[model samples]
Target: MKFEEIDLSPDIMSGLADVNYTELTELQEEVLPAILEGKDALIKAEPGSDKIASFVIPALEMIDDREEQEGASVLVLTPNPDESQQIDELVWAMGYHAQIESASVDMDSDAEEQEEALKSNVQVISGNPGPLADITKKLRYVFRDVKLVVIDAADEMVKLGLQPKLKAILRRVLNDHQTVIYTEEMNEEVKELTKLYFEDAEIIGLEDSSHMLTEPPKVDGMLSHGYIYVPNRMKITTLMAHIEETPTDNCVIFTASKRGTDRLYRTLRKQNLKATSLHGKLSDEKRAQRFANFTNGDVQYLLVADIPAAEIDLQRVTQVINYDVPSNPDEYRYRADLVGSGKASRVVSLVSKQDRSDINELESSLKQAPKELELPEKVKQKLKERKKKKKNKKKSKNKKRHNNGRNKRKKKKKKDELELPRPSFDKLSGGRKGQAKKDQKSGVIGLIKELFS
Candidate 1:
């Protein structure tokens, strides 16, 4: 059914058209009506499924005239700051940026910002559960007024680490209000969250998440995997080599540590490679900017750490590089998930000899081995040529330095020539006396020699 058939607000339809959203994706089609009818919803859709707009569109319509209200009537919460900002983008994408007062609440945000986020007039607030829970606990008056709550990326948020906080926030929300959950899998936390918070909630499960190897929506589509073995020393070099050989158009290189991402980003920059990085170490604004640039194709490559792996959408990346093996095996797929929403051809992971076990775990997770990939003979030869050129360059540089040393000795002699005493016109008469003496001596000697002859 078309969006107009669903009786959505005319303004929302206009915004949807502005963003070229002509028809709803399957997930959106399944979930939007339940949400519009003010029913609790449980959504399970894969990455790149346009799931954000499903909730965002209906939420916008439900509260368009609430701009004059004092407190937020609807709330959307995400697991981390990156996802929080992403939700903010979707809200704006739907042309609700002006009509909806939104705020992002994160642990790193200052108290004043957090307090401002609590404004009842701010109808939409997205943020990490910890900070949101803290606000609900401290400022119940503001959050209790919440009428609709959306938990995006529900499976990840339902983990024990974040579950209690999420539960507490849910408990404080007005019981009469609606709770909508979006998830990829029906994990225990998801099951429990639905049981506890959503009574008679509409459940929309796209596919069985248990058969992860075969059942994920885009897995059977145009996607493949490959691996490369780099001696511990040459991991980055091998990665650079792969990038040099392949199309890195909107690629993501996954690094394990914050420092790894920063180091790789800076190293690539020094080599004049155009890329940016994302990790917890950066401010929320910086991470959003880097993600935006990569999404918009303004930058070619993104050096990222693990937190963003499963969270932010990597739109149509043709390549993904695992710069290092992730600590979690699930992260291997998360990295792959970055590229293979459908169009990814290969996800090349760089595995060092010592860390070969990481690949083993990855295979175990996949239940099979990916095609073994070796550095191409041509690329290898090219790298060797590059190496030779680099070595030759260093030799040439040293030769220049060596020649410069000898040139300094020649220069020293020239400097001595420059230091010779010069005649001053001020001493013209005094300098002539010495010259006249020398001439007299020479003339006397010449006369004596001539007489002897």
Candidate 2:
């Protein structure tokens, strides 16, 4: 379907033309018409699909139709600051010709600036749910006139534990407002959201499949999957060797934990590799900047952890290196699918002994095992050194623990020897010193009086 056939406003059409957004994707073709008619919808589509445009274009059309509203006509709640900011930029580009005022209230940005933007005659507001919910609590009027409510990346938002804030924002909005949800897959949380918000809505792309399990993720046929078996201790060294030997231009290295991501990033930087790290600990600005660097080809490598694949739009990613095996089949698929750009790409995993079962599960889902790749000699040498180092460290730790135990025992014995018997209060008070007769029952008071005297 083409944008020209739709009844969008001239301004929105012009903006679409400016961005060359003419043809619609399959998801867009199926959902856009219903959305344009203000029907609530639940849509599940993968990343890099034109999912954002499917909703954004209709939202802009809706706001343009209701241009005279007093406050924001559309409210978009996203999972994180980066995703919110990305949508905000898209809104700016698509809404420019129409002169529709829009603001993004990313969670970690300056509060005063967000408040000031909210104070404007903004027709659209895109934001992270937590901050946006807080803002609406203080500034109740910001979303009073909202006609459209969009939860972008709903699955990820739910995963990030933003459902409470999303519900909070929904409660404040007018009950009659249209609600639309977008996600990479249908899950329990997304279902809960749909049940709570929509009476009966159009559910796209999952009619026959199980609502609980996500469709197996898939990449282009050109992408290849491979793995290198190494122990946990040598994973980093193996990763360094692989990057140095592999002629990859744009690559993303995925780690299962933030600590691993930071550790690898530090190692890469120390080796003077053009690399950056993306994880939850970074501030929004820094995360956005680093991601921009990678996307713009300013950096050749990116180390990422704990970030949902749906949250990021991986454009032209030549290679995806799994520094650690993915925890599940869905994860394996998502990471594999990130390798794209019409050219042949690669998904490489470093599987340790503990990760063998995970690899088997991924193979069961993918119906093919990853081709085993030989580790470089340098990585093998590093493996031996790591084993020896770990052994030495363990010996040192045991020796130190043994010495500490002996020292504690000696100190305890000395403390026991130096101890003296505690005297009873009666004996210390001279109760039986023979100062008073046995029949005299004056007790402690009599002893005190006698001592004073």
Off by over 4 Å in 2: 209-453
What's the lDDT for residue 286 in model 2?
96
TM-scores, all candidates, are: 0.43, 0.46
lDDT (Cα, tens digit) per residue for candidate 1, span 282-343: 78788888888878888787887746465666646778888877755555665666664454
Q: After superposition, how far is residue 227 of candidate 2 from its true place, in Å?
A: 44
Cα error, candidate 2, residue 72 (Å): 0.4
Q: Candidate 1, after superposition: displacement of residue 309 in Å?
A: 36
Q: Compose the digit string of candidate 2's lDDT tens values, residues 258-365.
A: 998878878988988888889877898999999999988888889898776645678658889988788766667777777774445788889999989887777776
**lDDT accuracy of residue 78 in candidate 2:** 80
Measured by TM-score, the strongest candidate is: 2
Clashing pairs in 2: none
Flag regions of model 1 displaced more than 4 Å. Answer: 65-69, 107-111, 206-453
> What TM-score does candidate 2 get on C-alpha atoms?
0.46
What's the true lDDT of residue 402 in model 2? 100
lDDT of each: 0.72, 0.80
